[model samples]
Target: MRKVLWIILGCTIASIGVLILRHSHVVTGGTAGLSLSLSYALPLSFAVIFFLINIPFYLFSFFQMGWKFTATTIGSVSLLSLLTSLDHLLPSFTLPSLMGAVTGGLIAGLGLSILFMNGASLGGANILALFAQRKFGWDPGKVNFSFDFLVVLSSMYSIGFSKGIFSVMSIAITGFVISYFKQKIALHNQPTPASVTQPLDNAISK
Candidate 1:
């Protein structure tokens, strides 16, 4: 039941995010953003490109992370790709580029936060972060930020300098917000004295 609920919720949030991308004409960060920018220049579906680009990362995640983590990542990535494809069918509209940048960033950040909290990823840099953490034990947040930075830097030609700059800012904001919430949640889930005492009492009783 929980998995089903997450599936439904994840797809819904991701679908809205893709709609925001379509309407705003603003590019995002990571592989999805790259796919969007390239789709503008080619005859490919953004979702298809997104899924294809993520495949290798998913394989990396499976080995470096674990099956449980990789399973959730797969579920989230697959749903996101499917929803993005379906979102294109819903409407054809546009919004101001700035508004698109802000709102799209917020929605993407929040949606990804939801997935991340559930032990999943929206794919791309997050998977790479897991690999980095496994190999170097660096902070995953910093690793993900660096990945986003490189992705944005590579976009100068495809998305132009000005828009690429905006994308960098948007991605930074989104990543900061997402990491903030995830950190808060992790803190909340830490063992408290009272909670820890209850487990000790149970063990003594047993």
Candidate 2:
């Protein structure tokens, strides 16, 4: 129940971030960016594209990350897709390009951070990133950043050079947030030395 709530919250936040980027006509990395790029040439919506693109990754998630994580991720991605589609119903507004880039990036980063901490993700590169972290002890953020850079670069022709650059910035911010917050969460969850030794000390005193 708690996990479900956190996943919903995380997906909601992440969808809002995606909405900001879409409203500003910007892109980010991962499957979301890929979907955005495809949306230009295809007749389908970004939400549909995003959801379809992630389908292949589920096999990998299931085999590598286990059923529980894979199920949670599917739920998270579905909610995000639905929410992002609903965003189109809202009244449109404009934002300055620079502000959009920074704010969108930060917002998206926060959303991704929450999803990651909760053991769910937006799928695509996120699944790969987590798998790499678990199998190879790699830093998921750096791995994600590397892939995101390539994804954003590939989008240059579609979104124009300037907007693609902004996409890169957004992904960079997202990667930083993932790395920083993961570390913080890890440290927070780590058993303290005092706690570990308390049992021994109490036994000795007794």
Candidate 3:
């Protein structure tokens, strides 16, 4: 029952995020931001574009992040896509860039936090981050930041440098919040290695 509730909540948050993006006419972060850019230039739907961009990353996630994580990501991605499609039926709103960026970041970050707590991801550069962790043990957040920088750079050429800069800032804020929650959850799950190793060292000396 608890799992079911969490799943429902996750879906709801994901949908609300889609609505936020649609209503605001702004891009969020992650693969979704790239998708938004492509959708703006092309005729593709946001969900379809997102799915296509994400499919290749699935193999990386499957091998590095494991099945449970991959499955949750797939489900969340699907939910986000459906919400994007459904959102087209509703009336859209016009929001200014600054308001859109901040609101989009907050909603999208909160939704991603719920997804992360459930052991999943949105699966774009995030998949790239997992691969980096597997190969070099690099911090996933750092890897994500590097890729986000690339995405925002492209946004500068495609849109304008100012919007791209704002998007970068918004993403930075969102990523920081999500990383903080993730670290807190990780600490809650187990003792820090420094503490555990100290006890072991004392035992060995004794």
Q: Indicate which candidate wins on lDDT.
A: 2
lDDT of 2 at 199: 33
Q: Each prediction's Cα lDDT score?
A: 0.66, 0.76, 0.64
Estimate the overall C-alpha local distance difference test score of candidate 3. 0.64
Select the stronger candidate by TM-score from 1 and 2. 2
lDDT of candidate 1 over 44-147, digit per residue (tens): 88767777888888888788767877887778767776677675466577887677777777777667655554556778897765455446644455666677
TM-score of each: 0.75, 0.83, 0.74
lDDT by residue for model 3 (42-119), tens: 999977887788878988788767787789778767666666677667775766677766776666666665555545
Q: For model 2, give the 10-residue run with minimal summed lDDT.
A: 197-206
Residue 80 lDDT in candidate 2: 83
Q: At residue 147, what lDDT does model 2 achieve?
A: 86
Judge candidate 2 against the unseen true structure and give its global Cα lDDT, from 0 to 1.
Answer: 0.76
The candidates, ranked best first by lDDT, are 2, 1, 3
Clashing pairs in 2: none
Under the 3 Å rule for N, CA and C atoms, how many clashes does model 3 have?
A: 0
